[model samples]
Target: MKTYQTGNIRNVVLLGSSKSGKTTLAEAMMFEGKVIDRRGTIEAKNTVSDNTEVEQIYQRSIYSTPLYTEFMDNKLNIIDTPGQDDFVGGVIAGFKVADAGIMIVNATQGVEVGTEIFARYAEQHKMPLVVGVNQLDSEKAAWDTTVDSLKQAFGNKVVPVQFPVAVGPGFDGFVDVLKQKFYRFKDENGTREDLEIPAEYADQAEEYRLALMEAAAQNDEELMEKYFETNDLTFPEMIKGLNLGILAGSVMPVFCLSAKKDIGVKRLMEFVINATPSPAKDVEVTVDGTEVPCDSSKETALFFYRTSVEQHLGEVSYFKVMSGKLTEGMDLVNPVTGAKERVTQIYAVAGKKKEKVSEMMAGDLGCTVKLKTVKTNQTLAVPSVDWEFKSIDFPQSKFRTAIKAKDEKDEEKLGEALNKYSAEDPTIEVLYAKELKQTIISGQGEHHINILKWHLNNVYKLEVELFAPRISYRETITKVATASYRHKKQSGGAGQFGEVHLLIEPFVEGAPQNNRFKIDGKEMVLNIKGKEEYTMDWGGKLEYYNCIVGGAIDARFMPAILKGIMEKMEEGPLTGSYARDIRVYVYDGKMHPVDSNEISFKLASRNAFKEAFRNAGPKIMEPIFNVEILVPSDCMGDVMSDLQNRRAMIEGMSSVKGFEVLKARVPLAELYKYSTTLSSLTSGRATFTMEYAEYSQVPADVQDKLLKAYQEEEGDE
Candidate 1:
């Protein structure tokens, strides 16, 4: 295979919602490029894009597949991404390397939640979009309705470059406004003929052509002046205006497509090759904000955006050449890790079938294997280049669960497999919560984690069970109290004797210390000698004050006493949660000269602190999260009611385009399966995100239940 320079390479990502025909459109594009002899359908499971066994079983894309097709003297590298929100990680990875996006919208459903979501992402990433209205040959296709929805969602930016001549089963061609010609497909094989517009559709085509001209003119001042004076633009001027408009994300040229019938595929590809920004024009930004142009003369630098472990390939790392050229057996250093690696082979990827290429110029996407230390998001460059590309910003996981091997014997294997999976999919977060004593796995949604489960069960041959993850609750006091504990031990050895007296009170920020305290209707005063303050690892602070007058307890025992207090704070007295934001005063104590050691003092202090915490009106606090949900207006009532049932406090509500934006603060415990529930309530039309806010005291009823459950569990243990 010949290596293409950055000027002739077009890197694009296919985006849309599930069942929106992204895979089918990708297949058609490949067929048009002659990369495949026959286009494959999702049902048949032989498509070049979704070639994974799991995807074939689910009949949807699970991973982003890199495919290349050469047409019009340009190498079009297309990354077909999964449309499901659960697998958005793949789409995000694609955005890191692709210069543009081809958003496929289902003609039958118009703009859906997934379409809106990917569009927003593309806008945020500043990647231009070329909208493709796919599945126009379906019996339920409604071209007018779909175009109307596009207008409603995108406002004046939605410009139609082409309109389907006849939708539904008879859909065979579309009238191109830019070319001023009618494209008629002779057969499903994309055989076409250019003819004049039909008399019945001439008026409609002229109206759209004018609209397209106006839209394009808004992109440049010169073009705007020309359009105003002449009421039209030349072919080259229109293409130039459209190209600028797309790069600025000010105009989305809508195209008609029936990918299933291979209709209008070549036209879309031709437009992409001509209008979309090439790598030569797409400047890459490094992590330190350094701009690197895609020039083959510069030193080599490759950004690894996606890494996967295939069955026989071991680990396949996908990368895009950021600068210079890459040749087989070339050595490069991972600037992030300083590890040297040799690129033994370079392959132009088309799903699972790889065409070995001797070299790949800058801006071309390809894959390699057997890199010792290369990982996703890492940049490999020559020693002189020393460039590290900016990493892909993946969304946080919303669904969490505790996972354990069912056989217990596969525990080690499960841990290793999960780590590998997490490395492949950054959205899957794995952590062993020492407090909860469970290995928790988090992902975009339940389905996302379930897919991991499918891999574990089928590929790894490991059976696992997933259960509700334990929330990291906190413990604190609300009032002042006092307690005393005396430790006396005698076992025919040196006896241990120590007694500690302490007062516990809630610690308020900027509060001064008090030397006098009233306990049980009695006043007690002590002289303060020393103080120590510590910030707890979990959250909050701990302050210890020594007020031992006349050395009632030796000064050396203070460390031991603080250690005991810390132990109790680590495992709170109420519900065994971490306690914080409390101050302790060791006013008085007694210690034996010979029998009192560190252990005795530690035991005495621990007991005293625990007892005082229980008597000081201890309270349980659960984590609160700020949740934002984007749901259709029709499903607003049901979603709000469901949130209310989960003790969610509605923060604000607003309307965006055609969706409702609902913000609320809800307890983490109630958000265990929120993503799944929201999908069900909205029929997979709603999406949401959650972020940690702050901890708040649980309601009395919730507190009572937690206490009862803790007591029962402790008793059983």
Candidate 2:
């Protein structure tokens, strides 16, 4: 493979909704460029982009695949990304490396939820966009309606540069509005013959061409003046103005293609190579709090955007040259880990296949095999350079499940496989919730988690089971109470003998410092001497006082009593949940000089604290999560009603972009399997994000049910 300069390289990512023909378009582009002798259909499980076993089984792309095609002495690096929202990490990875985005909209379905999500990401990255209406030959295809929907969703920046001459069955070709010529399909081999526009569609073509000219002229003041004077733009002037507008994000050129039939793909390739921005074209990147241009003459730096474990290749790290050229056998330092890795081989990757490349210039995406310490989002640069690129920020996992190994002997294997998969995909999170005593596996959605399960079962030969994760609840008190306990054992010499009196109360942040209580119908005002308040690490407070003026129990034994109380707090008396926000006052106790050791006082203190807690209005607290849901306006009522049924409090409601945003607070227990339910109710058109809010006391009925269930489980155990 020949190395190209930064000016000759064009990096673009393909993004759209599921079944939008992104992968098929990629196959057509590769076939037209002659990179592959024949295009492989998705149903056949042989497309270059969707080559993985998982993708073959699912019949869709699961990972972002980088493929390069040469046209007109320029190298176009196409990063084909998955369209499902479950694999959003791949789409984000593609955006990080690509200089521009080519969003594919299905002509039949028009705009979808996935399309809206990826479009927002492209806008966030400030990447120029080229919209392609694909699958024009489908029976339900409506080119004009799809274009109208794009304009409504994406604003007035969308302008048609190409229109299908004939759609649905007997679809032949399309007219290039920019070039003012009809490109008739010559054969099934993707060859096109240039011809004059037919008289029947000439008026429609002229109207679209005028609109294209207006859109192009609006980007440049000089072009606007020229257009106003002559009411037209020459071919070269119009192309120049359109390119400038695209780079500025003020104009989006929409093209039409029938990827399945191998029609109109070559023209799309030509537009990408000719009009898309190059790596060296005004791309500003920040390093170490300083902004720098992507110049080939600067110090060498590259960012690893994706990592995966291939069958025979081990670890493959895909990266894009950020500033300078990257050559084979270069010793690059990883600033993230402070480790040095020698790049032994550089390859141009197309799906799983790799072509040996001697060098990759700035802005070009390529892969290096087996970098020992490099991972995704890590920067590899020259040793003398003292700067690093920023890392990509991935979305947090929304769905979680507890996983366990099916075979006891494969526990270690399960852990290793999970860690490997999590490393490859940052969106997958593996955590061991110590409080719940469960291994939680979380990802974007149910499909995302199921894919990991598939890999564990098929790839690593480790079977596993998944279940709902347990919620981390807490226990607390509401009122004050007193309890006494005595421990006496005189069976043998030096038998244990101790007695403890404890006063328990709810700990408030700020309250009056008076100590008053009524015992046996008598009011007593106690003076707190040597009162000490200690804050528990888990949350809550403990106030201990030496109101035992006569020293009923030795001072040295107080530490042992406090330790015992803490132990009980960790495993609460009521549901064994962690107890919090309580004050324990050890006012008086009895001890035997010979038998009352640390063990005796500890046992007496623990039993007394449990008794006091049981009588002091104990309650269970469940965690609350702040959930933000985005759904279509038509489904807003159903979603809101469903949330209310799940014990959710609607905080606020508003509109974001075109979707209705509902903000609510919901209990963690009620939100189990919520992702699945939401998908079913909205037909996979709604999305949501949630984060931990605060803990609140459960209702009386719910608390009773929880206590009963826990007691039954403990009895069974």
Candidate 3:
């Protein structure tokens, strides 16, 4: 482990669809830098980037793991992100730290679903993007297909900076058109050699060179003038022009590499070192409407939207130092909690291996000492600015799992562990509903939350059972009724006496929905604005009032009645669900000189509300959510059909991720167990994310069954 200066830094995020060899590509990149003597294989689960236990077991990256390679006089910070939709949060985390993005495409698979997605994400963030056609050593590998696919999906902006010297099994090297040199790797396990460009590839190289020169020529008017005058530009000027186009996002240089064999990696490393944008080259960012220039000289805030508890590391937070230099033991104010704490230690991260650093400069990434109060999406900055960064907006969690401790005694620990994990990930959510008395875990998909459950048990020793989440259902009344009750008690010398009369009716029965309070067809609306009121309150005193309508229902008793109605609301009317938005009018009532106090009125009103609710048409309402899925185009039919079977309303769909991004709204009840079913249908290729959309009346048949079950559960309790 070693520390490097900012000039050699090239932070890159490894992004692609599943099985695209992102992990393998990262291994080769590190190997080329001589960080690792041998390139580790992904199948072997011994790579430097995918070192997490979960990643090792699953044979895939579970989260973004940071690594660095000191290559050719530069430090390449490689962020390996999970390609599965379940772990997109990891991808986004990587996106935040990187100065640019590298999109890997399976040579034969071409630019599939994931390539389209992460590419869009990169563009959305205005991150500079480059494409790499990997696995050229494979016999069936097709560079042209992938290149064309990228062009079709990414438009005319994608241009190749390098050309493969050969294709398929014959592929052994690449020729840099801009540099006019040929380089080859020795074997599937890598070693680089410089050689003459083959005669056949020389022509292709020249053709691609023209494409490169054309793009570069447009980058500067002087270069264009130079090109027109002589039809020849110096190699130095060509490379400079090409880099300018790249920095402008006008071209994404396509490189060829077989990460599995480590071929073509050396040249890729060289290109990144010489061409990719450094932290200084990155564009400026703004947080809370304040600009944070890419300057490592000043103290600034680097807000972390993701925080996790790495084993043996206490609490580790990954953040991009947005503005200023960050030194070990420097005090950082947590804008989230308003807590100021000193950074005890800083380490440049390489997967699980950490190289301690004395300080972290702007655009530098590393983890620091334990800070429990600072949770995800919290901002850490100098005391002067006192700002919070914008929150990361990701797809919502679609699947849900209701979980309970295997042993009742472990409930508190289970809650703590789950909360920490949630704070560490934007995709995972653990929700506890007091009314339902259940703990439901929601995530992007089943694998998302299931991985969390596994980690909970394996890492924290918390065992829990996963159950289907419960639907959010509500109860409301429909009819009107008047009820009266008296609370009376007598013991020894003192007595408690309370009486009240309350009327219950549909919350919005016959009323015009407006500010003027005009009566519609069926409901009587109240008009109290600019009205005179008789001075009255508890016989003589009044608390406060801006408008009183001819002393409507004795303003004093109105408060008492409101108190009782509030209590009844909690108690519920039809099925004991909390009631909402209802109006009650009291026209006739008698007050006892001594016994008819506000307390008495409150009690009577509570009882009356309950009695009136019995007459209202009470029904149960269930919550629903709008869901969106981005899956491979081939899986679209199966996904849409599955959604329809799950009682979903397919609103529409469009192209995304080289596939279809489907949109729909579904009842929460039907979505509870959709995680397991969707996995079965999509072969784990589809990812669903949803959020609270709306609530509507429950169907008759389903409502009847639910009410019956609720009644039985209540009886058992």
Candidate 4:
């Protein structure tokens, strides 16, 4: 392969909802570029993007496949991403490296939840988008409906650059409004004949062309003046205006295509090469807010956005040359870690097929294998330049499950496997919850984790079971209580004796301190001396006051007493969970001068604290999360009902962009497998995000159930 300069390289990402034909469109684009002799369909399982066995089994894309095609003197680097919401990590990674994107919308479905989501992401990233209305040859294709939906979602920014002359098996070609020419397809192989606009379609073509011109003209002052003066734009003038509008995200030019039949694929590629923003037009940012221009003259720097472990290939690192040129066997230093790495080999990747390339220019995307320590989101640059591009921020996990190996011996192997999977997809999180004593794995949804499980079963051959993860509940007191304990041990040579008296009370922020307490109808006063406040590692605070009057207990044993109290706090009295937000006062105690060692005080204090905690009004508190859900209007009631059933407290609800936005605070315990339920309730047309809020006390019934369950487990033990 010949080397391409930054100016002639175009990096584009393919995005859309499932069944939107992203993979098919990619195959068609490859076919048009002569990169492949014949097109492959999803059914045939021969497409370049979905080349993995998992993808072939599921008939969908699971990973973002970086592919390149040489067409029209341009090296078009395409990143084909998965359409499912569970696999949105790929889309985000795509956004980080690509200068522009093609959002494929299925003509039959109009718009879907995934479409709305990807569109929002593109808008947030300020990416220029070219809309491709695919599957026009399908039986249920409806161009008007799809266009209306697009307008509703995107307002006037959605403008059609081309419209199909006929759809539904009669779809041969579309009339280009920008070119003012009709393209007739000679066959399904993308053979085309250019002709004048037919009389039957001229009026419709003119209408869309006028809309396109207005949309384009509004983006630039000069174009607006020209449109006002002449009420039209020349072909070159229109292209210029549209390019500017696209860069500014003010216009999305829509085109029609039947990817399965290869209709309009060549034209779409040509338009992309001409209109979309090239790599030279993009400016990347560093971690420290420095802008790096995509120029080959500067020092060499490479940003690895993704890394995968392929069959027979130890590790494949995909990166974009942020600046300067990269040649094979070039040694660079990782700016973040200062580790030396040698780019021994680089390849232009087309799924599983790799073409060896001797050199790659700045702004070109390629892959290199067998790096010593380079990983995703890391940067490598020459010693003189210190550049680390900003990392991709993936979405939080919406689903969680505790995973354990079926065989105890495979536990270590399971940990290694999970770590490798999380490295490949950062969205998957794995952690060992000490309180729950379970290893929890979290991801976008159940399907996302299930795919990981499939990989484990097939590739790693590790059998694992996934179950509901235990919630990290906290125990706290709601009222004050008091207790006393005595510890005495008589031995042959020596004796141990210690007595402790303490008062426990619920701690509230900004509450006044109290010294007077009435116990057993007797009023008593305590002088708080040397109070110590500690912030619990779990959450909340613990304040301890030494109210020992007249030196009833020496100060030397205070540390031991506090240690005992901490042990209890670590494991609460009610459900063996962590305890928080309470004040402890050691008002009085007795100790044998000879036997009152640290061990004696520790035991006495431990018992006294436990007794007081049990007498106090203890309650269980569970973790709460702020959940935001976006669902279609028709599915609002059902989704709301499901949330209510999960003990969710609805915070707010409103309409946004033809979808209902529902906000609620729900306990993590009740939210297990919620993504699956939401998908089932809304037929996979709903999406949501969850974030940790604050811990709140559970209901009385729930508290009782948890306490009883804990007691039962203790009894069994």
Candidate 5:
């Protein structure tokens, strides 16, 4: 590898649907660039991009693999990303750093669901796109239909720069519309010879060439005028116009290729090297709130977009030089952790292999070995520079399961492995739900979680189990009731003697109407003194009235009584669920001067609260989530029916981006595997997102079941 300036660097990401031949196309590009002697096939599980064990077993990419190839005096850094929607995090990570995207569309499948998702992501990132109609030599390939679908889905901006002359068993050549010449591949080695346009396809070639001219002219006013006057534009002029159009996202040049046969790949590489913008050209990066340009002369700053753990190498960090230059052994500050780290080595990443590089120029993507403080989405810069690049925005996790180590002894190891994995992939999250007493692992979908599990078992050698998480139900009381308890234990020496009288009721804002605290329109107030209201930390209120005006119970013991009441509130009397939104009034009590200590008052108070709660009508409340499902209109009826079966309350329905959006509130219990179920129902065409909404009382039958289950578990314990 040789040092190159930012202008000589090209960062592009490969994106498409599963089995769209993105990996094969990448292999073809590498082979043409002479970086690899022979191409590796997906069926053999020897492709450079999908090198992981899980990917090999699944026969799909699970991570974004970065590789570089030099062609036409430029270093092309290609980030090959996974195409599955479940592994979209990899695609988004690649898009975050790449200057442009090459969206590969399967000729046989046309524009499928995954293709639409990648297009939307590219549009969201404002990335310039180059559409590659791949697998052109397949028997089922329909080039014309696929081209039409591309135009319809992506608009008039999509214009073919190359059209296949013949697309089946005899497919060996394509017409270059821009050059108005025929390129015939000599063999499977991608050797091509230029030839004159065939007599039979000359008319069709001319028509497509005219369309390309018009598409290119739409970018610049001067080009449009020149094309209108002469009815044609020179090759150089067309290239210039198309470059501007691509940079402005006003043109999407479509290329045809049969990656398996290595045909037309050389031409695609030529176009990319000639027309694609360099990383330093018009690329705007921001540090903190200040916009920074990609200038090598500026202060050193690097933004890490991906992180992974290699077999021998502990932590390999992939980054892009956002500004200035990154040299080996240079000390940089990790602004995220405010720690200074020395860059010990710099390497140009080629799949799992790395080549030592002296330095990485501005806008170039490379990797650093074992930075202690550096992690994904962290900014490394000079200590004097008080700036950090914006972090990548990953999608929220849509599916979750309660996970635990198969062997109790491996709990700590499982925790460590999960933390490292989650750090590498931001889309996966591990959380401990204290109320539910479960360690929950969440990801995009079932496939995404399965990969993590595979890594845990195979890579880390830790067996784990995943199951549905327990619902975090809450307990609350209704109505008003009074209970009294006395703790008098005079065994031998100093005795424990205390008595407590408490009036329990639901808390309500504003003054009591008709001399009653209404709990669901039921009068539940009791007469009390010193009615001082206190708010509990866990969503409830405690109204204490020390009607012991004559000091029936010492004032010093009141705090102990409140502490005992709080303990019970944390683990409620009914079902042991956290109690909320209730008021307890201590109107009267008795105490012995010699034996009434804090312990005695605490015990008496705890027993009194349990008795009062049992009489007050306790109810269980379950957590609700605000769920939004986006699906095609055709699947809306089935989705609605599924939601109804899950006891979901439909709030509203609307249309967004050609999809029907359904909004509803559903209980967390019913949504355990909703992501997988929705994917099955819609054939992976629909997606959904959810967030915590509020807690509401469970239905009477559900409440009964929960209480019974809790009691049975307690008995077993």
Candidate 6:
């Protein structure tokens, strides 16, 4: 591969809603650039971007892939991204490293929820935005309708540089409105010939051209005055203003193309090469805390945006050399961890394969192989670099499951494999329950977790069982109680002797001044809720208190009492859940100095806690989550009813795109496996997101059942 050095290396990311043909469009560009001899197809398991087994079998992009192309005179590093909502993390990561973006929208569907998601993201980052209306060759592909939708969704700034000349069965190709030229595609074989714009739609094309011109002219006062005076601008002049608008981050250029039919793609290629701003000309920020310009004149602060798992290629990382040159065998500091590692090997990656390279220029994107500690979203801080770019924002994962390896002996290997898998995908969470001894895995949805399972089986050669996660509830006390105990042992020269004298008081607000606890033997005390009174308050009341003046209990032994109380809190006052906020006062107690250390007091405190907790009232608390559900209006009644049954409270509601966005708080226990239920209720059109809200007191009957179940399960274990 030849290094195309023209100060014109443009790295652009391909992003859009799911099923928008982003990967296919990337393949078309590669094919047109002659970077590859043949185009790879998604379903055929041969696409250049969908290379991973998870992606190949799923027939979708699981991660972003970097494809390089030489168009016109500059090198284009096109980062193709997964369009599925669950894998949206990859799409966001792709944007962090690209100077500009090619957001694709299906011609028939126009703008969608996912498209809006990325558009807002691009706008937030001030990235140069470009739109590609793809699949013009397919049936129901209405060019006019898509253009209208774009206008409505994105506003007037989304000016089309070109429009499709036909739609659906009549689809042929696109005509360059400004240049007044049309490209006729030979067929799916991708051969094209230039032609004059049809005379019939000339008048309709004029309307959009004026719209484009007015949009472009607004970017420059001189151009605006010229357009107002003459009511016209030449094609080359319009292109110039549009480029300025793009560089100014005030306008996004929309173009037409068919990825599968290879129509109008060649025009897009020319526009990108000629108009897109080079990396050195775009915005720049520091990786550490120093200011660094986007100039090759200084040492570089290269940042890695993504990584991939390939059977042949070991840990290929897609990175941007922010300010300086990056070459094989050069060392750089990862600003995040302050770790240093050599580049070792530099390569240009296309999905799964790699082409070895010697160096990549500053402000350009390339990949390096076998870096030891680099991870996604990590920035390498070189000297003279000051500020770090904004962190990538990812969506909350909704899918979840608890998983454990099938073979006990494979536990270590399973853990190692899961760590690697989770590193590549930040959307997945791995958890272990110490009590249950189960390793649980969670992801965005059923499909998302299913893909992780597939990787574990195929890549790591590990078998596993996946189950729904069980709710983790905590226990505490609600009342205050006091207990005293004595420990004596006489079998040696120094007999072990200790006594615990403590009043367990319910926690209170004023307890801060009175919260001091004593330890004569084994005991712990906290002025917390539910320990204020001998009666079970299920909250703090501060029922127990004492001022042991004149050292009725030796102050030296106070530490021993605290140790025992700590154990009591951990083991729990009620059914061994856990306890807190109970104040223990050791007014009087005896301890043998030989056996009255922290360890002996810890044992005594455990006994004291059990006795005090039995007298005090203990209770359980369950987690609640704030859930935002967006579903079609027709399903709102069903959703509300279901939420009511789950003891949820509706907080707010709004309407969007024939759907209702409902904000509610529901217990986490009621929300497990909610994705499947929401799919069924909304007929697979509704989506939801949730976050940890708060811990709420469980209802009386529910609490009883949960407690009973916990006791029975503990006994069985």
What tens-digit string does per-residue lDDT give for candidate 3 at 447-501? 8888998889898898899987665566665555455566665665545455544
What stretches of model 2 exceed 4 Å from their correct place? 281-288, 510-514, 517-548
**Would you list the C-alpha lDDT of every candidate in the order shown?**
0.92, 0.86, 0.73, 0.91, 0.87, 0.74
- Residue pairs with colliding backbones in model 1 are none
lDDT of 5 by residue, 332-432 (tens): 99876889889999999879878899998898899988788788888999887866888898988999999999999999999899999999999999998
lDDT of model 1 at position 576: 89
lDDT of 1: 0.92
- Per-residue error for 658 in candidate 3, Å, reads 6.8
Candidate 4 lDDT for residue 289: 88
Scored by Cα lDDT, where does model 3 land? 0.73
Best by lDDT: 1
TM-score of 2: 0.95
Model 3 off-target regions past 4 Å? 1-5, 165-170, 187-189, 215-234, 283-286, 300-306, 335-338, 370-376, 379-388, 477-503, 508-561, 589-604, 628-664, 673-689
- Residues 1-717 of candidate 1 have per-residue lDDT tens digits of 677878999999999988999889888888888888998888888898888889999988989899989888899999999998899898889888888999999999999878887898888788899999999999999998999998898888899899997799999999998999999999999999999999999999999999999888999999999999999899889999999999999999999999999998999999998888898976788888889999988899999988888868989999999999999999999987899999999999988878899999999999999998888899999998678898889988889999999999999999999999999999999999999999999999999999999999998999999999899999999988999999999889899988999998999999988778777889978677889999999989999999888888999999999999999999999898999999999989998888999999999999999999999999999999999999989999999999999999999999987789999999999998999999999988888889999999999999999999999989999
lDDT of 2 by residue, 1-717 (tens): 688888988889999998899899888887877788898999888888998999989888888888877777888889998987888888788878788899999999888877887887788778789999988988999998999999989888999998897789678899998878899987777888888988988999999999999998998999999999999999888888889989889999999888888888888888887788788864545556766567888878888998998879999999988888788899999865779999999998888778898888888889988899888888888988766777786777778899999888988888888899998999999988888888899998999999999999999998899998887778889887888899999996679988999888888789756578775577766557767787866666777665665888898888889888888988888898888888777878899878998988989999999999999999999999999998878888889889989999999999976689899999999887798888888887888899999889999999999899899989999
Residue pairs with colliding backbones in model 4 are none
- Could you tell which candidate, 4 or 6, scores higher by lDDT? 4
Give me the displacement of residue 706 in model 4, in angstroms.
0.8
What RMSD does each model have against the real structure? 1.4, 2.2, 5.6, 1.6, 2.6, 5.2
Q: Mark the 10 consecutive residues where model 1 has the least summed lDDT.
A: 281-290
TM-score of each: 0.98, 0.95, 0.84, 0.97, 0.94, 0.86
| Candidate 5, run of 10 with poorest lDDT | 511-520
Q: Which runs in model 5 stand beyond 4 Å of their true positions?
A: 247-250, 282-287, 508-548
